[model samples]
Target chain A: MPRWEPDAVGRLQAAAIDLFAEQGFERTTVAEIAERAGLTKRTFFNHFADKREALFGPVSERQRELVVAEIAACAGSVSPVDAVLRGLQAAADVMFEERRAAVARRREIIDANPELREREWGKRAALADAIVEALRARGVDSGTALLAAGVGVLVQQMAMRTWAEAADGRPLREHLSDALLSLHAVIGQRSV
Target chain B: MPRWEPDAVGRLQAAAIDLFAEQGFERTTVAEIAERAGLTKRTFFNHFADKREALFGPVSERQRELVVAEIAACAGSVSPVDAVLRGLQAAADVMFEERRAAVARRREIIDANPELREREWGKRAALADAIVEALRARGVDSGTALLAAGVGVLVQQMAMRTWAEAADGRPLREHLSDALLSLHAVIGQRSV
Candidate 1:
């Protein structure tokens, strides 16, 4: 029973992020976010279950579906790590490529709040679990599936960190690829 | 102003784990844990900051110090992953080899509670940060250092899972070594 608004979700997210940045996440309220976005609390509720969810909810499910589908579609001969990176790259293309500033802002907000950081960790853990299950569906052994998924999550984290900090407008996929190479180089280097 | 009892910390931890496992973590109180250990709540607080820390506090710092020291002592010719695995193996020998049952029980307790799981994740992240710092001190680049430390954590997790589930009573160091080999096999396997 809500009037349709163009880009309600987008407005709500932007408003929420800006308010959180301005007043701090703990002090921000859903009603204030709705007011800032020129929407009702009911409409905000329709879009997100809570303030934290406003920042993270939509992308997790969408990214999970996209990454899992991409993994399923990969050639049978792709290495587990490579398959995971491919899925991650595909997800980056869809979710992160054009959202650099927003992503950086979100990171800063999450970093400033311990509760938000815990939720972010939970989200990352769930993403790794999804990737592990996807790899298992491809007949990967459980142990290797978990390792590859863990590696994939680590790569995504490293790439995201690098992408967020880089002033150059480099694509997230390139950063992801660079992260994978860095991992390989780290794993490959001799102690001497 | 406290009389030191032999193994007071150990007794408190064992009591906390048993109570957490028996009646669930949320319902278990610090006072009850102390009583079960035949110690005062003051004694318990002396050993741990809270009920949750009873399970994780002492070992994390010790393990961090041990692993960092081992990483620092590795031969100059060892690969980063190898050096990390070596450090992990050294720590496992001291802290994990003989504590399989207790460790498994602690994992089960943490796994059952969302808050505990978050704390566990935080502890792990801190450990990874320590490892990254150690690697950087060794002249490894920051990106590669983070990646290697992440892989080290993954290897430790895999080894811990395998060791906790194994009935053979094998040394944890062996499982740590086996996990490293498994990771190599996983990353080395051709997708085709």
Candidate 2:
């Protein structure tokens, strides 16, 4: 029997983050997370398969959806890299800007744990896959699509690394643009 | 005491690849690999830690060393992306160019196996990290260095994917150059 609880997933996620922060991720248990969220173990399982999913669950899929949709919606006039940046920036605005704190903490925890870092890479590969499909839908060639997706992923990672520790509270989208510019300079291309 | 054997590692790798091709990777045994090489299983253990390592062992570390050494030898006037390409080309000439058939077979086997794919990605990450270190030593800024390393990796992956499939017998260095040009075109920059 499922409890008809609104935002059960949200509650569970918040509870898991708090518990993961208080006790190390290795020490945190599903039972403790459930209790912290005022839910049962059944509800926890209903929402997430395991304790690690508690941290990686909600945002990863949704952000991918947002980016893919945005890429699909991009006009054909946009270059592949620009299209990817637009998609990434759109997702940043909708999914990341408000959740910077949680995103940073999640990254920190993942960085500290080798297992979580591996999972993060898997998640990244999936995102790139979706972007490739999205670009293909827009008539982009396979090689260009793959290259653009790889560049987009690199920019996103660099932006996230800076965005997390930035004291000036810059938006992730700007950081993404800046990273792209840095990449251009590194490649000896004129600034965009 | 180990038996004195010349080219034991090379013999083992060739034997392992042949056996892995004849039988599936899952069904192939280290003992069989050693036997195929006309060496004892003891010799196999003396050379490589496991079956997987037999495939990945010798080339990866040596390739990284070649890349790092070449990057260090680049003149100060060389840009990061060019410096990386030179390093990669040097390594490709020394480690990969002459071994196209073996490299292609190894890639085919790795691509078909999930465990090998995971190890492949880990190796790619390590190469990127080594590029980062090499660029840092050249006085490149961290952000640009990271981006350049990432770009180099993407170019390398794209080149490898094509190099394995190309019937034209193109050198991996030319493929790398083409991939980098594709990236610039994708990003709407003038091809270098």
Candidate 3:
């Protein structure tokens, strides 16, 4: 076991993002990331399976857990998509709204690296799966659950894109709500 | 210039799928793929940017173009999402419904290869972009176009999944319609 363990996961993530943005993700090493965080490589490994994991693993997993829990807590009176939107709102309240700059930096880092971008895509897909399971548990059928979950994730993507670009400091919760409305309009239009 | 060039693209793709499945995609070589198709390496290179490109490039691009063109040709009265569904239906009629087994095998090959999986994701994203552009050309705004396009792709994904399962042997166009109804129900339930 390594000795330096001061919020090792957070430290590793921040260091990895900073280093990836600085030296390019492919050129950066796990050892360098660990060293930047002032932790042993063993400590880094303990926190994350690898450098890419450090970038997205913990935070995404945490968000997934929170969203699912929130969805489960919702009553049957709420619509499936609304419950999902509420869960996404709860997730935004917890995981993203407070960490805007850091999340933006992380997105920038991932954008700069093709492998990291793929890993991010994989993480988004995994999160959609979690949302689908949560919706299913709320009595939605399998197919509808999958569709609602996908729409929710798409909303999240649009909100994040806007949030990252807006210098006026609009809150993610507001953006999330806006995205949900956009989704509704998109799906609500009358087919001639 | 290589002499052997009749239906070179199709012959090469069929040859590659056979060899990759028979000898494993990782073990298969471009030279072997070319020889198996009765074509030279120069002919293969002239047709595709690389070996992986042979598997996915032309078909996906053509599919996207076809969908977008079909959507654009629809009467101006069709709703954005409905236009997208029509586009998907048109593509399904031509590109997918006629080629179930081939697509199934291609999906299996992509499933087995991580790089191919990422490429599939990228292709889906590109298709979404194409749909969004077509919607915009029909006077839909950017934000709604993105949302409509994303929802349309979600429908396509749900349809694809249903089509892939052995139990759902219905034509892909039917599945696409079913998916659109499912989307309607999910978004319709919202008490906005």
Q: Best lDDT goes to which candidate?
A: 1
DockQ of each: 0.46, 0.33, 0.46
Cα distance off (Å), candidate 3, residue B174:
4.3
B41: Cα error in model 1, Å: 4.9
Error of 2 at B183 (Å): 1.3
Cα interface RMSD of each candidate? 2.8, 5.6, 2.5
lDDT score of model 3? 0.84
The TM-score of candidate 2 is: 0.83
Error of 2 at B168 (Å): 3.1
Can you tell me which runs of candidate 2 are displaced by over 4 Å?
A1-54, A189-192, B1-16, B19-54, B189-192
Best to worst by DockQ, what's the order?
1, 3, 2
Model 1, B22-106: lDDT tens digits are 9999999999998998889999888788877987888888898889999999877776777788888889889888788889998
Candidate 3, A1-192: lDDT as tens digits: 446466888888888888988898889999999899888788887778777898886888888999899899987888888888888889898889888888888888877776676677777777888998888877789988998888888989889988888897888888988898777767778666
Per-residue CA lDDT of model 1 for A1-192, tens digit only, reads: 667799999999999999999999999999999999999999999989889988888888888888899999998889888899899999999988999999999999988987687677677777888999999999988898998888888889899999999988889999998887777666656443
Q: In model 1, where do residues sit more than 4 Å from their true spots? A: A1-9, A23-35, A38-52, A112-114, B1-7, B40-51, B75-79, B190-192
Chain A TM-scores of each predicted structure, in the order given, are 0.94, 0.93, 0.93
Candidate 2 structure quality by residue, lDDT tens digits, B1-192: 667789999999999999888787899999999999999999999889789888888788898899999999988888889989888989999888888889888888886776666666666777888999999999988888888889888898899888878999889999998888877766664221
lDDT, residue B85, candidate 3? 90
**TM-score of each predicted structure versus truth:** 0.86, 0.83, 0.80
The C-alpha lDDT values of all candidates are 0.86, 0.85, 0.84
